[model samples]
Target: MSDASVPKDRRFPIGLTIATLVAFVILCGLGVWQLKRLAWKQDLLARIEVLKTAPARPLATVLAGKGDASWTRVSVTCAPGQAETLPLVYGVRDGDIVWRATAICRTSAAGYGAILLDLGVVKALTGQPTPAPLALAAPTQAVGVLMAPKSLGGDRAATVARFAADKPAPYILMVESATPAPAGITPAPLPAEISNRHLEYALTWFGLAVTLLFIYAAMLWRKMRS
Candidate 1:
């Protein structure tokens, strides 16, 4: 015959119980944080997309704030001495591999200081960059969208420092002149605004957290019954 009363000796293991609870809390916390990130990322992407379509403003107006300058358009004056090509970053343009030469430009405005300017794209087929630094003929006005240097690895701050010319702003602006890029270059189109996968990552984190909780509960129930 089966015993009607539960065994008096049976009890939850204190250490295991504590560990499970801690893990459950941590997982749930991560899930909540991811939800918050999802909203923020969505809003940022939307704002950037809008900036891509909006009319261009003066460099000063665009530089007034960096909060939403991800793709904000601006026009500025540039000269050969004011711009220095730092390094090249690569991307696909029209089914062809191309390298973008990002340079730092010290604009005419003293208060605005300097901003990294993306000169434009040089085709991989061009080979070895021709190494002609963006030396403009004279002081010329240019227009572009603001961008931040992207680090494929390591710290972004360090990357920015390496490219900086005379303490430029933390942001980079992809500038294309109304006339044309210097030479061996074409305008680098703005990258897709919403290509970042933060939303998917957030959902994945939330799913993992839910799965962890469900498994923990099942194990706890089974342990109690035994």
Candidate 2:
């Protein structure tokens, strides 16, 4: 005694159907993009692991493209320059706002320009948002990984501009250890773990897309029955 067919009098929601389909496509697209990011992140993490264990090489070797430089451990002896003050980059350290100090150190190596050293966060800001440049009083024999300034929230162009009068290297060295460590500056060593959650993000987006489809189907069924 019950009617099984969808009611012919009930109008289909053309606008609502279009909107739902559009949203579904966008969500699925985001999921697919995240999958691509996952693959890239995996490769980067693997490279980082290998570089961390490999013996440190000369900074010049990597700079000249003779070896892989990105995240590679390299050793360079930094001779203190005539510049009295170093550049301070705005960044966060351990959930607190901090200024990362950077300096261009003169290297005696041939065919290589001054190496940019990321000396790590300033210990005492003393309430100054942009802390005054700290002095590099002693020469540093640094052993650290070479990284791009941009990746660490540094403006590569701006950094380059700061040393426009003098030649600076293409990459920045994240100082891990200095022979006679700079006073009041902590070493921001490379993180042992790089979090890769693209897969989880992708799954979340995909799940949402599926849920949306189910919700729309239920609604459509209810409308047809009425």
Candidate 3:
């Protein structure tokens, strides 16, 4: 081989090394982020467990208290015949497409002017259009968990603002049971448990980072030998 070619082949692979380092840092960062997520998820699951078994508090009382209100059990009564059905929300149940029914109870809670109520889910079978509101039979009394709306980031703030514009509380009341139960709707209670797989995800990312470093070292060794 020519003298110039020999030096070129033996020279350190600066470009490849830089690329590998960048990739390695990114993979490691992902792993660390997942670990942080694991911590947050663990705390969440514990809170859910505590809230589930606690006695149902009045909606007004729960709203007035401080700290995280999500997943809290609450009780409220809707004015007789005051249930106004809202638009259906799309959802999935047991791997099947479904629609969640909801409604607004005017002047329901003693202090709060209104509150959003999650009636239940209805299967969206093929060849069927949106189901009509179930006879506007709003439940007179409902005991359920308070859940945050599904919106994220800026959308979540906007959702809260929109719901609270007239006076409704900013949370959705997932009705577990009601006096004179709602018809044509199956109770869609919260899941018995929430899955926490962040530890597994973090391990996978860390493993990839280690694998990448080994591969890069092998390539460098081969170049030097050649």
Candidate 4:
């Protein structure tokens, strides 16, 4: 290699070295955090698998039982002659952004109030959100996996109103209707989502930290030779 192409005297400055060390420590910390997350996720998935085989109970019965009933499947009845509610949100499926049409069902049960069932989806059109009335106007029975309300960022007042209004079942249920949906609308099935990709994520962060250490060592070697 030409002298011009050679690296000049590179100083291993204490500040740079310290900064790199701090970053390396942070990266490793993140990897360890991910590993802990993996363990928690594994335990959650195991619990869900066990819950699935158990027979469906009335929404009230399941709610009465313990240990975070999120993901427990249940049967619910929609009150007749009530208007369908539409909660507009955006979602991702297979890496594509799609419109989420969540249909709300006002329950007839005595204790719990209302439930939001997935009203399938519509291909998002350019420049505007998909319109309302995307689900059936009639009432029906449903089978769904109950879940905690997804975070709605920082809109606390709106969140309280949206999630707690009309005394919704403590948990949100993404249900597939036992009855047919409105014409042109598809049945939104309950998602069996149990993610355990944290181990892979941890490995990736650990790999990057190791790679960076190697690169730092190579730089030091070149500087010493120069």
Candidate 5:
């Protein structure tokens, strides 16, 4: 087509150019934001690592006398109790069952409260039926991480009640227990703390922005030449 046949309105080209630039800028910003998020996640992972290695503190101390502070990790000895005392089951692995244990004990602050314990998975033996009352012996030490209690809204409560008959308990504990059981009862180790991908993501985004800028410039030059 002849150059004269092409619409010579400045508005169309300019509007398109501006839109493209805006899109490129937005994409670049998102990429950079992802990078920042990555860095924050990495730092958090490192902090968690330090917390894991540090000496296990009392659950009560970490709880700070608040019923809501359940995400702190702590070490404690399991008191002897009947299996029925185990709270609702959250998950199962390798044909073994796991239960949440909420232990009531007197804290140093002179108050009785409950601390969650993650009982390792237990399996039924070939001859022996599943332990009906999975009684746990007391005086056993437990090391676990504290977590916030899960919120089961009304809708979720009804849904979960179908499978888990018991009411949801407070907090979750990732524990290393000394209970005897079949293999694979031990939970997997926590992942290492570090987030290095953010830098890469940021670079990718910035590179895209640069690329878009160049493409836009080339298009503008060609249009002007024509």
Candidate 6:
């Protein structure tokens, strides 16, 4: 075909090129955002590692008696009678029902006592079975990590509130321990620590923005040439 017959339709081609640039820019922005998130996550992981290795501090010192700050690891002994065992409904598995036995530990310090420890889960045949009691008395030294109280907002508020009201006050709490210690037991070493992933999320958004810009530029180049 002749050069003039090449059909240089600026309207259609330009419009499509513009739309593609827009979409590509948006998607690239998202990808860049994810990358930024990855960096933030790495930094957070580093901080958590430092916390894990640092010397153990009392829950009161860490929290300042205020319900602020999360992600701490420490140790405490499980005290007899001081540890209240409660069943957590994790839903039915197979034909039998499964429930996790959670223990609330009271420490020696006043107003600064209390930690939640998960013992384990048990399958029930019919009615809910009573969990085996721990055999340690208060003043026993069991090592544990410090943690922020779990939030019981939204859909599960009612259920969580019920348990909170029934149980004695808590100081610092442990989550997902590997083994159950006797009441008044002391943890030999401190627990692991982790940091929040918000920074990672922020980075992801920023990365996405950069990627989108590149893609938009590429699309513009192709459109101009056509």
Which candidate has the highest lDDT of all? 2
Q: How many residue pairs clash in each candidate?
A: 0, 0, 0, 0, 9, 37
Error of 5 at 90 (Å): 9.6
Better of 4 and 6 by lDDT: 4
What global local distance difference test value does model 6 have?
Answer: 0.47
User: Which residue pairs clash within candidate 4?
Assistant: none
> Lowest-lDDT window of 10 residues in candidate 5?
151-160
- How does model 6 score by TM-score? 0.49
| Stretch of 10 with least lDDT, candidate 2 | 1-10
Q: Which stretches of model 2 miss by more than 4 angstroms?
A: 1-9, 66-68, 108-112, 126-130, 137-140, 191-193
Local error of candidate 6 at 112, Å?
Answer: 5.9
After superposing candidate 4, which stretches have Cα over 4 Å from the reference? 1-12, 94-98, 108-111, 122-129, 132-138, 151-165, 180-183, 192-196, 214-226
lDDT of 4 by residue, 1-226 (tens): 6756645565445675787798899999999999999999888778677865866678877876777877777888777655545545555555555555565677745466776665555554212444553434534777767767652212223433674756766566655555655444445444425468999999999998998889878877877777
The Cα error of candidate 5 at residue 82, in Å, is 4.2
lDDT, model 6, position 166: 39
Candidate 1 has what TM-score?
Answer: 0.71
| TM-score (all chains, Cα) for each model | 0.71, 0.81, 0.82, 0.69, 0.59, 0.49
lDDT rank order: 2, 3, 4, 1, 5, 6
Overall lDDT per candidate, in order of appearance: 0.62, 0.76, 0.74, 0.64, 0.51, 0.47
Look at candidate 5 and give me any clashing residue pairs.
Answer: 70-147, 71-146, 71-147, 72-146, 73-146, 78-140, 79-138, 80-138, 83-134
Residue-wise lDDT of candidate 2 within 1-226, one digit each (tens)? 2344545546687887999999999999999999999999998888877976788888877787754467888889877556456567776656677776776777855466577788776778734676667766434688888887666675745766676555777678888888777788887857534789999999999999999999999988998788
- Which model is ahead, 5 or 6, in terms of lDDT? 5
Model 2, residue pairs in steric clash: none
Model 3: per-residue Cα lDDT at residue 58: 86
